[model samples]
Target: MTKRTNYSKEFKEYVTKLVVLDGRRIVDISEELDIPYDTLQKWVASYKTKQKEAEDNRQNALLSASEYKDLYEDERRRKLELEEEVAILKKAMHIFTLEKN
Candidate 1:
């Protein structure tokens, strides 16, 4: 009967990071760490999934922020246009009143 080896979570995470962040190959890491190739492959896949999720979340947040900024700038421009229109209307009213007097 083959003995089952239990690896710690920290150890697994460290190996996964080496593959994911350090751009090392799974086969090389597995051979270096004396772990099974399939096991290390699975760990790398899981780490990649988590990294993709984090990247997607960050992109979504940045998109939302950009959209909010665009809306704010649009509203500010509209407010300035309205203020200019109001000033023009006030000047026309003043001209008409002076003509009538």
Candidate 2:
């Protein structure tokens, strides 16, 4: 029986990136990296899947950030409007008290 080989994380990542992102074919990458074709294909598939998941997460983060910003701006506008209303009511009360005197 032959021995099974285990690759390191950095090496596997490098192989995956070269083949999946850089458009290198599995057979070519396997020849260049001296890895098995089946293993290289598996790495490429996994890398593509992970890359898509990462992009989706980034988009979600951006959307959440924009939503928070909009909510904050709305709260600020509401506070400013309430302040103006309170000032107007105070002025009206002062004028009524003067007229009553």
Candidate 3:
């Protein structure tokens, strides 16, 4: 029966950061740290998953912001068009009232 060695959370995170942030080789780190290569590899893979999810969330928020901006601009243009139409109608009413006087 083999007993498992427990690694601290901070140690695992630091090891993962070496790969995610420093772009260091996992095998080299594993050998240097005297940890099994598979363990280091799994830690880095987990960090990559979280990184990907964060990137995806940022992308989705950016897309929604752009869509909102486009919708606002469309509404602004429509409002301006309606204002001009109303001004024309008011001026025509004034002209007719003058002719009747």
**How well is each residue in 1-101 modelled by candidate 2, as lDDT tens digits?**
85689999999999888877688788988888788888888888888899999999998777577798999999999999999999999999998889553
CA lDDT scores, all candidates in order = 0.89, 0.87, 0.89
Task: Report the lDDT tens digits of candidate 1 across residue range 1-101.
Answer: 85678999999999999988899998899899889899899888888898899999998777577798999999999999999999999999998889553
Question: What C-alpha lDDT does candidate 1 achieve relative to the native structure?
Answer: 0.89
- Candidate ranking (TM-score, best to worst): 2, 3, 1
TM-score attained by model 3: 0.61
- Model 2 residue runs over 4 Å out of place are 64-69, 72-101
Candidate 1: stretches off by over 4 Å = 64-66, 70-101
- Backbone clashes under 3 angstroms, per model: 0, 0, 0
Query: Considering lDDT, which of the candidate structures 1 and 2 is the better prediction for this target?
Result: 1
Report the C-alpha lDDT of model 3 over 31-83, residue by residue, as the tens digit: 89888888888888888999999999998777477788999999999999999
- RMSD to the hidden true structure, all candidates: 6.5, 5.6, 5.9
Spell out the clash pairs found in candidate 3.
none
- Scored by TM-score, the top model is 2
The superposed Cα distance between candidate 3 and the true structure at residue 46, in angstroms, equals 1.0
